[model samples]
Target: MNPLLAGDRDVVISAATASGKTEAAFLPICSRLAEEPAEGIGVLYISPLKALITDQHRRLESLCEHVGLQITPWHGDVPKSLKTKLRRRPRGILLITPESLESLLIHQMGWLKTAFAPLRYIVIDEFHAFIGSERGCQLLSLLTRLGFLLDKEVPRVALSATLGDLVMVGKCLRPAEAGCEPAVIESAALKSSLKIQLRGYLIPDRPHDEDDNPVDTVQNQIVADLFSILRGKSHLVFANSRRWTEYFAAELADRCAVHALPNEFFPHHGNLAKELREQLEARLLEGRLPTTAVCTMTLELGIDIGSVDSVAQVAAPHSVASLRQRLGRSGRRGEAAVLRLFIKEQEVTADSGAADRLRFHTMRCAALISLLLKKWYEPPLTGLNHFSTLVHQVLAVIGQYGGARADQLHRLLCARGPFQETEPAAFAALLRSMGEDELISQTHDGQLVLGVKGENLVGHYSFFSVFKTPEEYRLEAGGKVLGTVPVDGPLLVDQIIIFAGKRWRIESVDDEKKVITLTKAKGGSPPLFLGDPLLVHDRVRQEMFALFESGECPVYFDAVARDHFEEAVSGFREWELADRPWLVSGANLWVFPWLGDRVVNALAILVTEQGFQAGNDDGILEVRNCSEAAFKQAIKTHLAGPRLTKKDLAARLEGSPIEKYDKWVPKSLRQQSQSGHFFDLEGAYQWLERKTDFLR
Candidate 1:
């Protein structure tokens, strides 16, 4: 209950969503600041999103006012005058993001060291989002660097709605380079009843044309169901992708028009304009209108969007943590949280892949929901070599100090810092490449400073973001800005497209400014807002396998979903996958490893290295032009030969840039990082061993 409020003692408060985590953290913080006044900024509150900062500010305004403290929300969106005011007189709680904190460390070290001299505690909201990510890595490095500047310890408090890997969470909260052990405070649960149903639909095997009578559209039916279920009520629909989000929102709005009803559904995603996103947030907070936001993961976290009636998921959720987080948005005030899952499986044909025939999406979603019920989630990933963040941090350090020695950079970063997987040789090689590539320059006295190229990179606004931001074209219709889209291919002037939950006709195109002008159109498909797909965990797949192996029908399935589940089970048995590791087709093999994406990728690489064409498609490994016997032989030979480490497995990997800062790091080091993080070689190897033994 006390939160162990002692000097330099870290704490982690993990509880259910909408369970007053911010108040829990700030109560003690504000109390301490009020009871014992300190000069300069007393507390530094970090958040993953600028919107989250706004949400927290609104929630804590009255509380801070009651405690006689000022809370300043600092980010790119805040007015420069307000930021200037805060800079001139730093006091009370300074709410910021990692990027803004990075900016201060680089450009205002003199002011920051003084301002943070009396900083008592650092609080990170949505702590899970930062762990095992590039931004998270940058955050940890910034904290460590801040500690070095202060020459003393500052205790940290982390707040989250969902968490796993308690040990890893503790370690990340207080890295080896800072503070004491983290004390965890977690609640039992939400404890409310869950009202859930998974409804399935079937898409026609043949594509429908405009001339086709009685056109069968699974999407339309699903949208119709959504309109009937969510009309005149507030809800959140997780459509899994920007394309789906836009399409579903547009379809629901169109349905409202056809029925002569007010539009209640709106689209929310990363591509939308900031003002539009803020508008949606404001409407949700107003709590008057019947609003439903069809969104991607943007609304999954704890962004105070008022109370909602229910949550709907359009596709199979990638992770249990995400599902749990999305479900947490509902079931407030002692009401049962309602969930309606919509799953659409394409009609099977002769050329349909194994995943489609087996209804893999349905199985996977069922597995994730099961795990969510069991209160199990994937642990935070560790033992990764984030050379990308290391590259950014090294440049950041040089910028902060104006110039840094090689030994100091190495000592503060790779030696005793977070990037322990990087060896001295790899790091030295990276520095040499940086110098050669003009990312950094070495003076005659051997001190590292930002080169002309490095200065250009770091001075740019995009430099502050550790994650990759794709180049996109801003879309405008009439005088208002709609949203932006990444043009994957050439765009014509009269192209019709769906964006921002509206159908648009391209009026004109300005390639130089990367802007597309549009006019309202009747219908169009969503453009390619290309992004990396989520990786599925092995546990989810294992549960899917268990479902088929054990012949158990889940109670949450609807009539259509039950039919799909039964069909999938029949197909699984017919293919004889339960007895063997693969199914044999003419001159090809369908490998069912039932592992996570990374391990599947690792096996694919190994098979490809052995002179076979392989690809991991939708959790099923497809080996082209390789028979079961040949594939079996390759595995046996690999098992008998020298163990292939990550480096060895990566020998045939394409050395392209995956992270934002990968271009600056040496090719070999980049390869090493990818080799370590991109694949679970050990996990793959164990599965291979088991499969081969079963074959024998």
Candidate 2:
């Protein structure tokens, strides 16, 4: 327990969640700061979340006080006075977020070196979050620029409880320049005693002649089941969506009132007021209130709510890694963590037997819990080719410096930033597009300068994020805005809708202006399908396949879930599709490769490239009218190649809009980002190669 220090070299501390890794990381940095007591910022702690910054600040502040040092948390919520204080007297450690850091780099360009002159250590908390996101790429570019500005080799330390691929995570953080050796400190010895239980709710089969409503019955059953769990233990119930969180919270509250139990439990999501979220967090952590808060991904990271008895996931917690994080929240402090997974039964026709339905549910449960027990979390992958982010960052850089020469910009962007591999021609093409769009101008000094449009974009808060967000109209009812809704769809007046757990009717809509007004109503609204595509990792699919093949029942499965798995396996065996690459049963042909979204997409491209018509829905990939011979041939060709070129991969992602600015980016760059190769192309290729056996 010598703190697992990585010395002067860059390092990674990958350990289980709730492990002493956080302390292990900070102890060395704090010890170093205490010994030196630098006048300027000694350490820069970058977290993916604003909440994490606040959480770590409190923890570090106490340690700072113990070591007689200073720590400051700087983000949007941090008072301007505190930032001014830091500017005037920079010292110890500075906890900040990527967005805030981006703002600081832009607004305080003159003070970049002075503000961080003494900065030596850079710790990226939850390094896993940064790996596969545009934000991660943005952070890498920003760090490179900061290093260039300071003209120093800063040691970076990445801390994460879950990492599917440690080498890739390290590579993403490592400087491209040679001689910068980064060490990885992986402590797999830290394990959690988590008892995960997968429970399936059976939906009574409705005959074709009967007027049966599955939604109502399922909703009532879910409410009753949720109440029973709440009655037993203090728990955290996770819903995949904000709307569901609200709906479930209201339903549970109503059920609790009927049962004469205290209705102290509430809902916590992004749309809720900051005060309300903080209050819930305080109550959960203090354990003063025996409550089960329904939440979305907002609660997945950062905010600590002490130890709870159990975690109940309304549906598959999206991914095994996410399930692990949610389950890890419970069972802290030597207590066994309990996770109850409830899967809503989907309607099935006579053609679809109990085995088919059970197969889907059981496989999902097995895959999720298996990965969690194996301690394998998906490492972050690179996102959509972000030429837009590149263009935006370039403009931001120009705005800060007034103007930058072409060579200087190229060196800064390509040699140092995340776009290190981007060619000069591509950069030139981007500049031409920007010039066409009037976002940047070539000055008489032969340097790139931000145009008026570029200045406006940089000034806007929305530009801070590289992700695309739909232009949404604020849903207002009774003078309070519930949340934003996509403006792309048509809205009819007087239509009843469910949002934030309340029923409302659209009073009016200004189609041209993209605004909608609403009033309280009972019921009569169509369900809104917000296209929130789940990122299914490649490993999850493999685990799902394993679940189907393996006769062993997972420990997490309840009676219904166990039955479901058994039935699904039987169905696979009956159809002889368990080992088949693709199965054609009637109109629906299911391809069970068990690959993540990216690889599936790649396969889709591969199929299309081989002159086969294909489409995908949900988790299944379909090739229209494909013969078995053609399918086998395509798989063989794909496996025969050493690897697909970046160009070929980009070709597959053509017309796939992942980010907001993606639609506007040149086809080439968009392809690169959408290919999701920022982490490791080799791993993805290997995953594809391994799946070729499934074709048999």
lDDT of 1 by residue, 202-236 (tens): 98866555434434478788988999989998999
For residue 566, model 1's alpha carbon misses the true position, in angstroms, by 0.2
Poorest stretch of ten by lDDT in candidate 2: 523-532
Candidate 2 error regions (>4 Å): 1-7, 190-192, 203-216, 350-358, 382-384, 468-532, 608-613, 617-619, 625-657, 675-696
Candidate 2 per-residue C-alpha lDDT over 479-540 given as tens digits, one digit per residue, 9 for 90 to 100: 76677775422233543455664556678765345456788754222222123345567777
- Once model 2 is optimally superposed onto the true structure by TM-score, how far is the C-alpha of residue 278 displaced, in angstroms? 1.1
Q: What clash pairs does model 1 have? A: none
Compared with the true structure, model 1 gives a TM-score of 0.89
Off by over 4 Å in 1: 177-180, 207-216, 470-532
> 346 in model 1: Cα distance from truth in Å?
1.7
Q: Which candidate ranks first by lDDT, i.e. highest?
A: 1
